[model samples]
Target: MSAGTGQRAAAPGPSTQKPRGIDRVLAFVERAGNALPNPVVLFTVLFGVVAVVSTALALADVSVTVPGTDDTKQITGLLTGAGVRWLVENLVTNFAAFPPIAAVLLMIMAVGVAERAGLLETAMRATLARAPRAFLPYLVALVACQAHMMSDVAAIVLPPLAAVVFKSAGRHPAAGLIGGFACVTAGYAAGFTIGSLDALYTGITQQAVAVLSDTHHADVNILANYFFTAASSLVLGLIGGFLISRVLEPRLPAYTATADAPDASESEDIRLTPAERRGLLCTGLVVAVYAAVVLSLWLPNGAPLRGEGGALVPSPLLTGIVPVLFGGFLLAGVTYGFTVKTLSGSEGVVAAMTDSVKNMSGYVVMMFVAAQVIAVFNWSNLGVLLAVKAAALLKSVGLTGFGALVAFILLVSCLNLVILSGSALWSLIGPVFVPAFMLLGMSPALSQAAFRIGDSATAVITPMNPYVFLLLALLQRYEPEARLGTLISRLAIFVVPFLVAWLGILAVFYGFDLPLGPGAGISLK
Candidate 1:
């Protein structure tokens, strides 16, 4: 195929043209996607440029120091001069230290094998096609959330599939694309079915507490919101689909041009010859047995997944959740890989690992820059000061529970435009709010949950979301006229529903003093 010629398979027979509606909307989106700079490249360059400039200015003593701090003490910094090398070194170490990267690595291990074997893609498409119409949207949302359990699946998979789903449904393709992207990307932080974000945030908050108080008692669990979020996810997903169908669809304009649909392609469905099927089935059974064994460990009188002396909060199982997640993904991936021809032999597993790490390049860049930004802010004590002051201000106004949670969400949503990483924002705020709220009869788990809501709800609208701009590019494939404003405005209608529904669920959870998970309580007691 020529470079610019769009790929095609078997296009569905054309439906009646809605000349004044979806056609115009798709044209606008396509145009807008083409107009914007590649977001990944833009962010990568901006981050690199900012890091170099900031380091240089700090070295030259030309950078403006935040007031109330001694210029020589905070500003005559080494970020540029002697510090540049140190910054890079520290960033490397920090990147290494970030457990999420490791989780991403592990997930990719199995993921690559699954993909190479063609099992993953086939399963996804087959599942999509088989999903009931009434349940289709929720299934899409579920799959999108689960995509995070695998590395970068949403960015590479969902946009294209979304268009397919919409087109297949006789709805506007862009709407399906945008909705899927929104659910996957925006709800990135809320996958309580597994323990990825829950683990990262908990560790950060716990570390923050230790920094302030020097105590182990401050430990928070990664699966703190497991049940709460899993249930709430279903609710938010329903709201998401509703928003797309009612508000978002009406707001989008009719497409002026029809873009040819990409041909749906699938890898050879590995018909597991009966022997292979039994092997695969046995492998799955072994996994289930192993999982049951591991989970049973946490149910005993004082397991780590349990809180103190049988409690669930502050459980060691929760604290060390990253490794468990790694293990689960690794086991499943390896099981499927080895049992099926996908793994073929040991060499294939090694190749899968290699490919997984190779895909880490973009994340490596983002993390390197993100680490420097965070380290500098921390070193300067600026984040601490701001967080402390913010906490005090909120406390003074008697903000607590639902209202305070809402306010925090709003603040973080706005803050997302300037700072996007969940860990970065929480690292700054966790120190202050976790303890402050804990003192106000709230638990660190609840505080983190609130932050997550704020963090996720605005992700689709935030320019800082790493993948938001990628969606725009996909939009260009179908609608060449769409712009950032067009995308944001359409997403805005969802902003209210998401914010309200999420906050409302949280409020009820808090008001009832419900457990977010097995040991994850809404209150400190």
Candidate 2:
């Protein structure tokens, strides 16, 4: 069961010769990303820029005709007295109502208990213990892809644990770290089932779509990209697993554990203890009962979870997904916690929830600035105007249908290198592209699918990704000399193939006219 039995020799050191094209590109990206300000500061700067630009555009009487409507909308300068008053009045409401914040926070609160209770750690150990050595890379990749349901927990926990798993199996821990990070970031938008991310993005998409037209409105269900993303999880798992074993492993130096490195001896004790086993059983029972109760409300005729006339798209289940995540995780976590002595009573559970909230302080600050940016952009009428103008420009150039879709995907992929936050980037561009694509006979869901593909494919290589730095720090535990370039070069090996494969999947979906999810399709009616 040793992963290092037939390991290849280490890759050669960096050449003194001039860097090639891709190396030069990555070096530039690393430098530029390092030079950029923190995301919160960047968003704050963007707010100021938007305000100044809005004033200038308003003074010039800049306007655009709304697509499918006779009315023309003019920019509203946010620096003006009226605009200032509106901003002051709506500041708190803006942050409170930024679609993703509440949903993200709620899910975190619930999943945090499970993470804090050692449930997630136990599960990973038990799963890895039974898996064959030869299949370890693929198994880790697959599990990491499916771990998207747990939100950021997987990204934070899996890399270090994977390093341990591989080190115990006598494999290069750096390769395991690389594999874990690649699957987590590259397959970020793909999952085996709907998760907080789906709810978060769907809300943003709904808001963007509502800006363009209301006549064709149906609820943008949280599962809008379910089938496509679920399929992507499998595709990425296989491809990512292969790249890690065949490509990344050979390139890494043989792992030599340091004092800070995870102890391989600890792997023997990773098995579930008696108490953890009991807690896991109880957690499973709780999840099953909860699922049965929820399904009872949705599966029967004329159920309450189903919306009026039994339409699943507009159902309470889809709209209420965030709360369901909170409840489900809370129930399972509490069950496991109490059984394992991680929670002695209600007070212990409350403490865990409080700690989770404390962990979100940084996110709260970022969202505060992001909210203002979004509100100012919308108030200025820039987003809608940009969409209309862009759509017109594309039509003038005859870039419609599939060509436009591919171009949009590439655009998003390039932007991902500079803009790291998926939600933040979507807020900035979603209004423009979602409506613009709809004008070209595509559905908002399809635009979202393309955007997700682009966003995820480049995530692992982007220095702007906050997780990239974290991954490097983790890598240093095994290979203290590991640098940003090292991780980026390793991850870049998979980025192109991952992008191509995902785009191909989208093409097939479009060609077959398959529904992206329940009541969601590739084209507008």
Candidate 3:
């Protein structure tokens, strides 16, 4: 498969005569992107300063009064202080923790192989190849949201693919960009399949839930939100598509008149080879076998995916789900590559893996900044204070059951702007609220699910979400004039529908007393 984007203006040779209109816009985007503060550097510096100051203040006993609480507590300080070796160790260990990271890596491995083998591109081209031009926006967003399970491919790869797809379909490339990013950002929380953030958040959540509930019980499953998430994915995807086609596309500056650009001007020129096709078939067969095995292990009486009593929805396999997405992508990617001749031997496989890791260099850097910031927040007890204050306010409102859960989600979404990291936020909130809600007869698992929906739904609109900014930087490729507020505002409209749909689904699940994950239910037993 071809890389989904146009390379650097095809070398600016004959066109040095200067650009007009849209070309000028494209040029401005490129220049502005290069000129912006490197997000990585900026975050590192900012986080470092915060960590240092927080650490120093913690040691000096300079404590802030806990909001809404009569008790004062000492900050843990940074993990690096004299008596803080365990804190430092926990940070390092958390960063190095597997399961989630490994899952992401494995999924990408297979997906990269599939991408290299031309499977994804062919599939993308083929899937919507016949879709009516009107449905393109919905299709792009839907596909991009699902693409989250494929690592960071959507952010880096999909928008350009979207532009090319829109162009090939006789539509404006700008519309494609908008549609693609919408899915990537807005669908951030709605993955039906496994995703890295899903794994990370689930893992952290289980630990957090244990803080107040049964410490020995691993009650929160990683895929606790899957079934409902899948349904909403389709809903939001369609909504985003309609909004773009009817509203945003018409208003975009570089509007092309037709639904698709002529095929002759398309950039990638990717075609599936016979071997690649065979490889894809083989990959499908392998997946089928894999699923069968999983079913054998999980669908039989007392299968892991089922609940303690053999209920399908609340299965352990479903809850503690280690999204095999990593492995799935790796296997699919390698299969496609080998079948398509993009990969020749073991050497090719290793190289592809290397390249995949290389692509993540920036993420690694960002993670360090993110890690330090979260570490400091925990050390300062700021996150706990925030969670406690909010939980108290929520309790005092006299709302109960689903109304309370809905309010809790809204509160979490607002808090998301400041906290940004779902796990960190949940780590603070879950202990306080999970059991608190459980006391009110809500399942801890279900509360965890609500927290996730709130966490993800607001990610696209929040400036504090590191990935949102990174995505905007990527968006500049097509819309150089795109501003943060413009992007967020456009996204905000989508969020209203997304939040509505998400809450609606939660209500259905709760009303039915549906299982949220393995041995987990919407209401406490």
Candidate 4:
């Protein structure tokens, strides 16, 4: 099959433009990357490797002392009869109950209603269609940064929306698609406000910390990275806007508008009518009402939403974030649909939900194999073992201060090239990274903040991100010559600006040793 996107092969079309030095290098990189097997196959190979290695290490009697205590964990061989049986018994159940599986699918179902109702698209189109020419790029970047609140749906929705926004302003739709995808992926770990990501990331972190600590609890507040994330979002938007207008916009080769794209003359006329305007207002009111009801539950002492002892941070409200987001979208979508008459009755609602699932079929298939790999890795205790080793090596070198954080960020960045799923990568590394940092006097949130920087900065350049594949296909509509290499060259321009801004944000937090978020500090002490 093709790469992570599961797309069919294409016939050659227009000849490619000759490349210079970096383009040539990136082109070579693209060849090498695409030469590799599909992500599902890659993950399958990874599973086998983990299995073999676990057996070899176990046979060698390899073990490590858990850092905070005297207890030792020996590497368990997945090839052993006991190990194989354990894997067999839990394999199906593990995939069924994988944490991200439930969160992502639920988010899709909820946000799908908003999307299918046309509330999201109409509202965005209305706002961006009227923006000033110079201000449009910055505004799109800003919105892209905050789109994390839309959850997994953000990945599926924002690129096309941004394309329309650009096309409305008489710019290349392909530039909008490429740049929008970059911004959304780079903005994943960072947002103007807390979103579904924080909840999902926090849940994985809690489990990681629980593996090694009794004293230092991971953030119960989903706002753990909010302070850093919000700041980075603004920085990325400003710099991204500048680059988009000057760098990305100029670099795209000329192309005629495809049938899928509206002509320049027609695109300039894109706008919302009165009906859509009313629908947006109704949607806003519905969302507001939903938020008010949810918050009121948390206001009362020992209420259903609050945590133990009437605390808000560690509450069910915090942990049950996925459902809260689900409700908000469901209500907002239905309200907009009814107002606009796009949705008629209960049948329409169900049809909208069904369409959402149809869109997510690819993601669902990918997650199934991913779940199996993660399950086997956890069962083998390889993640813990790797973390213990990493901690020891880092501590021995006396790596501390901002340098330690930088090293960790860089490591994750390199790995992002191969592993595109943020949750999957975090889950694999968190068990090792979190506890190890805690041992070095760093807070779990600090390591997490560092991870956010790494996770986002390189996504634009990586061919492996499934969303990148999605964007590439969209780009090909206008420029049939646009291969992965050409797309990478276009996307690569954003990397330096993104990395510099993200690092600068991290440095501000690191140098001052400031709080990373609500009640979350840079160090445990």
Ranking of predictions according to lDDT: 2, 4, 3, 1
Q: Evaluate model 1: give its lDDT.
A: 0.61
**Local distance difference test, per candidate?**
0.61, 0.80, 0.62, 0.75
lDDT of 2 at 208: 78
Best by TM-score: 2
Query: Could you give candidate 1's per-residue lDDT for residues 1-525 as a string of tens digits?
Result: 121122111222223433445435534544554555543454445445545655555555553322233432333243455566666567667556654455545545655665665445545565575565556666676666555544356556875676677666656668777888877766766665563455556656654544224211344555777766776677877877777777665666774435444533321221235545554575568679878977887876755467666765456666666677667655665676666656767787778778867876665565555444445544443334444455567778978557787777898877655566676677556665775565456777788888878887777766555465677667766666555545666766666777788788888888888887656688765
Positional deviation of residue 482's Cα in model 3 after best superposition, in angstroms: 6.3
> For model 2, where is the 10-residue window of minimal lDDT?
1-10
**Per-residue alpha-carbon lDDT of candidate 4 for residues 1-525, written as tens digits (9 for 90 to 100):** 153222223534324544567656645656666776766676678778889998998899988776667777777899999898998898789678766566666766767777778877686677677889888888788777877766656777777777867877778787777777778777778886555467667756665665454344555456678889889899898877887888988877875877755456656445777898899988887788888899899988767888888887667876677788778878888999899998987888888888877876765666677666666656666766776677788878877677888898888988777666677678667777887787677888888888888888887787656677777777766776566767777888887778878988889987898888866888875
Global CA lDDT computed for model 3 = 0.62
lDDT of 3 by residue, 1-525 (tens): 011122223323534655445444434544544554555565566556656765666677764443333556555555355425645557676466523355445544555666666666666655555567877788887887677665555666677677777776778776776667767766776767666666656655554443333212345666666776777688778877887788777876774334333244554443444664576688788777776777787777866566767777656666435554555666666666666677778888777777766776665655555454544455465444444455556668877678889888998987665565564566445645764565466666677778867876766665544455655554555565555545555666667777888788888888888776546677766
TM-score of 4: 0.82
Candidate 2 lDDT tens digits, 1-525: 011111111223545455667668866876787887877898899899989998889999999787676777788899999889999899999888877787777877887787777777777777776667778888888888777776777888887777777777777888888898888888889877556678668867876776565334545667789899989889888988888888889888876769978777867665678898898988999999999999889878988899888876668887787788689888988898889988869888888888988988887788788778877767788767777778898899899877888899899999888877787788778878887887777899999999998888898887666677777777767876665556677888888988998988899999999988877899886
TM-score of 1: 0.70
| TM-score against truth, every candidate | 0.70, 0.89, 0.69, 0.82
Off by over 4 Å in 2: 1-23, 169-172, 213-218, 250-262, 473-484
> Candidate 4 — which residues are off by over 4 angstroms?
1-19, 148-181, 193-223, 246-261, 300-302, 358-380, 427-431, 463-490, 513-520
